[model samples]
Structures are given as C-alpha cells and as structure tokens.
Target chain A: MRIAELSRRSATSIPSIKYYLREGLIPGGRTTGRNQADYDEAHVRRLRLIRALVDVGGLSIAAVRDVLAAVDNPDLPGHDLLGIAHHAVSPTPARRDPDDPRWQAAREEVVTLIGERGWLVSPCSPALDVAADAIAAMRALDQADLLSSLPTYVEAVERMAAWEVAAVLARGEPARMVEGLVTGTILGEILIGALRRLAQEAESARLQGLTAPE
Target chain B: MRIAELSRRSATSIPSIKYYLREGLIPGGRTTGRNQADYDEAHVRRLRLIRALVDVGGLSIAAVRDVLAAVDNPDLPGHDLLGIAHHAVSPTPARRDPDDPRWQAAREEVVTLIGERGWLVSPCSPALDVAADAIAAMRALDQADLLSSLPTYVEAVERMAAWEVAAVLARGEPARMVEGLVTGTILGEILIGALRRLAQEAESARLQGLTAPE
Candidate 1:
C-alpha cells in the first residue's frame, strides 16, 4: 500500500514511516516502480508493534528496536519483552548532576546493580540518577526528615523488594516468568489499593482515638 | 551568630544555603553586621520545614514556595499543613499535547471530571494534560497491543487515583499525606509483586491439574 494508507492504518505519519524504514526500525518495502513500493502484513505488524512500544509504552526508539529484535528472535524468552516494557514504562530514572560527587557515587552503584540484574535499563536515564542524587544530597541538611521517617521508607522499599523477589521465585508454567511479570504489572496496582485502604483504616482508627497501630 | 552558625547547626552547607536564598526557595537571613547575616530559632524551624518538603516530600522549589506561602496565609487552611503537603508533593501531572486533537478532548474531560468530583487538580499541568492526551491517542489506535491492554492500564491508573484519594482520607496527622504519597509512589511496584505471586499460584494450580473454578 501507499505511505499515506499505511500511515492511517498504522497510526503513524508518512514521514515517520519513511524514517522508520531508513533507520531499519522497519524493513523497506519491495520496489514496484520508480515511486511505488509494496508493504505486506509483516510490515503492518512491525509498524503497529513499534507504535505500541514507542508511542504507548514511552520507549525510546533504541529501546523499542532492541525489544522488537528480541521479540522477533525465536530463541528469546517472552520475559525479555516484559523486561523491556517494564524499563520503558517505569518512572524515568533520576538524572545525575555532572559536578555532584554524590551523584557520581550513586550512578556507579545503580549501574552496577542494574547490570548485575541483567535487565535492559536505559543508558540514557542519567536524569533519574541525578534526581536521586539531588535527593540524597538533600538528606544531609534534612536529616530530621530522613531520621524521623527513613526507617519507615526503607522498610517499605525493602518490603516491596522482598515481594518482588518472592513473586519471581514462584513459578509453574514454562512461561511463568512472562506471566509473573505481566501479572506483576497488573497486581501491583491492586495491592496499592489494598495498602491505601489499610492505611486509611489505620489512620481513621488513630484519629478517633482508637487503640491500634496506624 | 551568623549564616555560618545556622548552616553548621542545620547541617546545610553554606553553598546550598546561598542557592536556596538566591532562588528564593528559602527565606533570606536577617542582616547581622557588615559581612554577615543572623537568623534565629524561627528561621531554623522554617528551614527545617522547607527541607522536609523539598527532600523527603519530593516537591519542586516552586511547589515548595507556594505551599510554604499557603502555610503562612490566614486565608488558607492554617492548621492543615499535612493536607496542603499532599498537593505540594503530588507528582507533576502528565503533559498534554497541543497538536493532538484526541488528546485535547481527553484532557477536557479530565478537567471537567476532576472539577465535578471536587478534586483540587492543578490547572498548570500542561505536561500531565499532554501525557493523558497521549494515552488517549493510544487508546484511539485500536490495535491489539494497546487496545487489549488499555482496560488493565486504566484499571492501574484508576487504582492509583483511588490510592491518592484514600491516602488523604487515611491520615491521622497531616504528615501522613507525605508519608502516604511517598508510599503510594511505590504502590505500583507493590502491586507488581503481589500480582505476579498470585498469578503464578493460579497458573501453578492449573499446571498441577487442580480443581477447576466453579
């Protein structure tokens, strides 16, 4: 089909389609004449997938390419796609300030940790790293805030990490890892609902002068 | 005795103190002598409060300034720093795209609905409006990757919205809002863990050829 037809069908623009082809994000269509080219189902599917990952999932072009390549490779597990999707959809990591020593230290740790996990973290997320660094730097001045509440915050992150680790370990279907990751995304929201309600009940109890831990 | 003393006492560096002053993030120090400025107990307390909101509470400098101003104004809720803090620390709303008609439509609905529900959503979140618009644009795509998954995504965002609402209702002290917002920020992560575990169990039971659901 023509570029405009494909664009309307795929929800991508004509120029974007040409760019994707040029970038090899999608394969070039067969040349039928000087200006005409033929695109098939594969091209359509690929374009749609690209849009979903980039436009919907907020993945960068590079990340989408890497993920699609993995998805197309038969040897790759579906879990890899989930990992990429998670990386894309997760909060953009804090950036690191170039002059900040604390940012430098945190960057090293985050890079090491993410690499060791063998997950597809974006190399471009220096912003999230620096944001975290700014956060860390502020702690020294605001020790009161950290000291007063950090045990709770740490406890919370730790609990979440434990829950994640535990969930990853529980498997059955050969695609358990894939299911686990997808389910994790969905169930994560539900658990927040549960926690919020629980916390609210605890707080209301405390406000009414009821005796129980809030 | 001077800015340096206040700095030493608060664990803030002289540079950060200066930055805060220059940015008008924190109030200026009272003049002492030819080359110094003096601050007292109130300054110390106010600075501590500012640090708490910016650091642990994760508010931007502008947002922090606005909230602090509200705290000082008699026309606002004088005793409800905690509730005010909730708005201060809420994530920057998603951006809306001006070029996209579908997105513009979605944001209009979001604005009307938020007002109808009486939620004090900020009108300044052009970014959030765009994001919500982008998400709406994706929904309009009608492809499987997006269309099939949107119900779940909406479920997730709605769940997040519920957490926001519940956290406000659940607080005994105003500080709970900060704690709850921080806690809720990771609520998605928590849900991810729980859902993975639960889905795995369900799948495992099926693999074991267990009893069918009634």
Candidate 2:
C-alpha cells in the first residue's frame, strides 16, 4: 500500500496523513523509490489510532505523542504505561489563588472523598486537581448540591474503572493492553458523556410528562 | 460597584471581563457616567457563572452564551431550559462517510442501546450522534470491547440523570432550578470525569500491588 491508500483506508486526508508522518506520529513507511514510500498494515492501524485520539478523544498532538510513545515501549509495565496515558489525556488543572476559600474547601473535599472511598491515588494526582476545580466551580456558582451527589457519581465511576482495568489487563499482550487502556480511557469518556446526556433527556422527558414512564 | 470591582470580585482579569462584556456574554452594567458603569451583585454573580462555565466546565464562549440565555429565560420550563444547556455543551458530532459500514453499524447499536434502556430521546438528538461517533471510533481502533460495556455505562448514567432531574426540580424557584440543572449538567461532567480517572488510578494500583487492598 502507498500513502494514498493508507489515507483512503484510514479515512484521513492525504495532507493530514503526511502531517502525521512528518510529525512522527506514525512510523515512516518503507522507501520504495525516489520520492516514494510504501505503507503497510502497521501504518494504517497507527493512523486510525491517531485519528481516534485526536478526533474522538479530543487529545492534543503532544498528548497523542506521549501516549504513542508509551504504546511503543512494550518493556514498560502495564500500570506505568496506563499512568502515562492517563496523565497525557487528563484535563489541565485549573489555576487557583491561594487565598480563595472555595478552592481551598474544594481541595480538602476532594482529598476527603478519595480517603473515604479508599481510592489508592497519589496525593498529587492531576485527577484530584481536576475534581477540586469542579467542586470549586460548583460552590462558586451556588450549585453545591451537585457536589452533594458525589457519592453516586463515584460509585458508578469506580465500578466502571475497575471493569475497564480488568478488561485491558485480560488482553495479556503488553502493546495491545496499552492501546486498549489508552483508547478505553479517552474514547470511553466520550461514550459516557454522550450516554449521560441521552439519559438526562429521557429523565427530563419523564419528569415533564412529555413521555410516559417505563 | 464598577468594572474594576466586578473584575476583582470575580477573580477575572480586567481585560477578560471587558472581553466578556464585549462579547455580550454578560449583560452590561448601568451606565452611570461617561466611560463609567455601575455593576451590582447580579453582575458579580453572572461573572462567576461565566467563569465556571468557561474555566471549569470547559465550555466554549458560544456555549456559555447559550446557557446564559437559557438561564435568563425563567419562563421556560425546567426541562426545556435543561435541554438548551445540554445541547449547547454536547460534543460536536464526528463526521462519518455515508458508505462507512462501521459507522452505520455503530448508529444502529446506539439506537438499540437507547431502545433497550427505554430512553425517551428523540431520533435527532445530538447525544445519539455523539454516542455513535464514540462507538465508531472504538471500532476503528479495534477496541470494540469498550462499546460492549455500553450497557453498564448506560445503566449508571440513567440512575444519576434521574437523581439530577429530581434534585434540580426540588429547588422550587424556576430560576434556581434552571441554574442548578445547567451547573450540574456541565460541572457534573468535569467532576465525574475526574473521579473516573482517580478511580482508574486506584484500580490500576491494586492490580499492580502498588497499594494494599482494604
């Protein structure tokens, strides 16, 4: 296969495929002749993965690079590879002034939630910051009741996360496991986010009598 | 209170506040004199809401505007208000070629999931498109197991969405109810996403024996 076929099969534009190749997001194809190259199945798979990350998972180019690097390093432990991918896709922590009481309170609440749930996350985990940022925003907006339901959200997420980790580990291939974890983590968010909204519409319709209850 | 005071109280920079004002994201304060305006507590609150939506909720400026317009329309029913907010913040649907079999299959799967769940969403809901996009991406990346777990995710999200609708409606005041739903829907995503990542870390650690189980 050539670059044109790779682009067509991967559903990516030729220019975008060239860009990914130039940026080393995908390994270079074999040199077939002067100013010509031949791509293979590996290139097609990598291109699809890159598109999935950028288009569906909303990951930045740099984040995709980091995740791909982890994917390429089969010697890395599964857990470490997952950690690198998670860190790359995690939201940037919101800035908070030291004197901001709401942020301080929210940060403390995040720590408490982690402790109460017995989650074995590090104190410095970026997820903690992301959680606190959300809490602080809720408090600032006078919508703290949203946070009051944190336990329910945590219960659902914990169960799903556990299942996800087990599923990826069950693959038994280090490279494939890492790829599963990365795609599952990022694309999984999109899936859940969309499902939640659909559920909200259904629930709202039921409440409004727009649709009868099941 | 003046623009300076609004900026200080909202913890937003003067230029940013001015930008919001210019963008009409926030209503103008009363013009009290030449080149001077008197902002009140409402302005302060609105600024905070804008910041929460933009910074923590990761909503675009256009999304923030749509949500704010919904907030201002207290006459709108709670469900309708929520619908507007949800539509605004929903992820833009990924493009799919009409001839793509994977996408067509994913679309049918999404519809089936909704039907099995007995969800009352419309056929044209953008959430459906978002879900299908995720499924298609998962299939393209050869991580279809992620979509296989869609049932579990849908069950959890449905429960949470029901609780959220009830919580918001219990607020009594239409304005407050709408505000609660908007904040909960948007900020709740951030909170859940962060919690999910934290839970994943914990699960990963336990699997790797990095932390002792309780």
Candidate 3:
C-alpha cells in the first residue's frame, strides 16, 4: 500500500501521517523510489494507535511518543508498561503546598480508600496525588458530604479495572496487549466520562419527571 | 472585607479576582473610596467558584461565564440548570460526517444502549454524540471487542448518577444545589479518572504477580 491508502485505511490525513513519520511516532515506510514509499499493515495499525492516543485519549505528542516507546520496549515488563502508559495519560496535578491541612487530610482519605478496598497500589503512583487533589478540591469547595460517594465509586471502578486488565491480557500478543492497554486506558476514560454525563442527564430527567425529547 | 481579604479567603490572587470581576464572572464589590471596595463573603464564594471552574474544572472563561449565568438565573428549573451545566462542561466533539457508516453504526449503538437501559435522556444532549464519538474511535481502531464493556460501564454510571442527582437535590437551596451539581459533575470526573487509574494499577499488579513497592 502507498501512503495514500495508508491514510485512507487508517482514517488519518496524509499530512498527519508524514508528520508522524517525521516525529518518529510511526516508523518510516520502505522507500522504493524518490518521494515514493510502500506502507504495510503495521503502518496502518501504528497510525491508528497514534491517532487514538492523540484524538480520543487527548495525550500530548511528547506523551504519545513516550507511551509508544514503552509499547515498543520488548524487555519492559507488562506491569511496568502499564505504569508508563498510565503516567503518560494521567493529569499532572499542579503542585500543592505540602503543609495544606486539607490536602494532607485528603491524601490520608485516599490512602484509607485504597486500604479499605484491599487494592495493592503503589504508594508513589501519581494517581494517589491526582485523586487527593480532587478530594481536596471537594473539601475546599465545601462539598464534604459528597465524599460519601467515594466508596461506591471505588467499588465500581475496582470491578471495571479487573475486567479491563483481563481484556488486555486476553490479547496474548505483546504488541496487541500494549495497544490494548494504551487504548483502554485513554479511550476508557472518554467512554466513562461521556456515559456518566448521559446517565446524569437521564437521572435528572427522571427526578424532574421530564420526558425525553421527541 | 477588602479585595485582599476576599483573595486570601478564596486562595485566589487579587489580579485574578479583578479579572473575574472585569469578565463579569463575579459581581462587583461595593465601592468604598478611591481604588477601594468592600467585598463580602459572597464575593469570596463567587471567586472560589470561578477558580474551581477555571483551574480544576478546565472550563474556558467564556464557558464559566455562561455557566455562572445559568447558576445566577432565578427562574431556571433545576433540571434545566443541570442541563446547561452539563452542556457547558461537556467536550464538544469534532463534527463527524454523518454519512460515515462507522460513525452512524456507533451512534445507533449508543441510542440502543440508552434504550436498553431505559434512560430518559434528551435526544439533543451533547453527551450522546460524545459517547458515540468514543465508540466510533474504538471501531476505527479495530478494538471493537472492548465495546462489550459498555454494559458494565453504563450500569455503574447509572447508579452513580442517581446518587449524584439525589445529593444535589438534597442541598435544599437552589443556589447551593446548583453549586453542588457543578462541583459534583466536574470534580466527580477528576475523582473517577484518578481513582480508575489507581484501581487499574492495583489490578495490573495483582494480575502480573507484582508486589506493592516497599
């Protein structure tokens, strides 16, 4: 296949495919002549993965590069690969003042949630700080009562996470499993976020006795 | 209280409060003397809300203003108020070509899911498209098998959304309820995302026989 067919098959633009090649996000194609190259199924898959990370997952180009590097490293353990993918996708919380009492309290609350769930998470996972940051925001905003929902949220996500891990591991092939990890990590968030909003809308309508639009 | 006091209480800068005032995101303080104004506790709360929406919620200034307008409206129904807030906070998916079969298939899948769940969501809710966009991406990436998780995701979110709506309604005052709705909707996403990552880490560790860090 030529670059044109690669772009068409991958649903990516020609310019983007070229840009990705230049950025080393995707490998170069076999050059057969001047300004001519032949792409293969691998290129198509790579382009799609890159676009998924950027478009659906909302990862930065640099983050995408880092995630792809992790996926490409054959020596990296599966668990470590997931860590890199997660770190790349997770938000970099604005540094908080360590002495802020609310922050400290929220951090403890997050740790307690983990303990109660019997989740074997690393103490240093950036997600710890990210979750604490949100909890702190809830406290700062004086919505402390909403914290009660944390247990439900934790329980729900625990099951979902297990299902996700099983699905990724089921892929068998290393490359396929890594692709699944990146896609599941990023797109799963989008899926959850959007579905939550839809459910919220439905719930609100139910509470208000409002009918669906015609 | 003066602007300084308002700033200190809200943990926002004077310049930011001024910007909020200038942008009409918050109300003007009572003019006291030359270059001096008396700001009340309301000012502090409003500033905090503005910062929460901007910094934590990642809402654009214009969107924040629109959301504030909805919040400040005296006659808006609770359901309508929630509708506006959800729309404001939701991502505007890049417009899809309607004729694309994959996009069409994904959109119908979303509609079918809503029907299967008996959710009374408005047809025009942007979340419908947002969710559809994510599904389309999955199909495009050839990871359609992941779509099987939709039922689980939908069920979990339905329960969570019910709790969210109930919590917001329990706030009593319209203003407080609106505040709860916005805070819960936005921060809830951050909370869920981060928590999901933490859970995935724990699940991955369990699956790979990896030990928690010492």
lDDT of 2 by residue, B92-183 (tens): 65476647888778888988888888888877788788788778878877787755577789888988898888888788665566567667
Q: Predictions ranked by DockQ, top down?
A: 3, 2, 1
What is the per-residue lDDT of model 3 for residues B101-125, given as tens digits with 9 covering 90 to 100? 9888888899999898889887888
In terms of lDDT, the best-performing candidate is 3
Docking class of 2: medium
TM-score of chain B of each: 0.47, 0.78, 0.88
**Against the true two-chain complex, what DockQ does each candidate achieve?**
0.09, 0.61, 0.68
* Candidate 3 lDDT tens digits, A113-195: 89887788877788898888888988888888887788889988988898888888888666677677777877788889889
For A127-175, candidate 1 gives per-residue lDDT tens digits of 2353344334434333223223222332343334344434543442223
Model 2, residue B80: what's the lDDT? Answer: 79
Q: In TM-score terms, which candidate is top?
A: 3
Evaluated with DockQ, which candidate comes out highest?
A: 3
In model 3 chain A, the worst 10-residue window by lDDT is A89-98
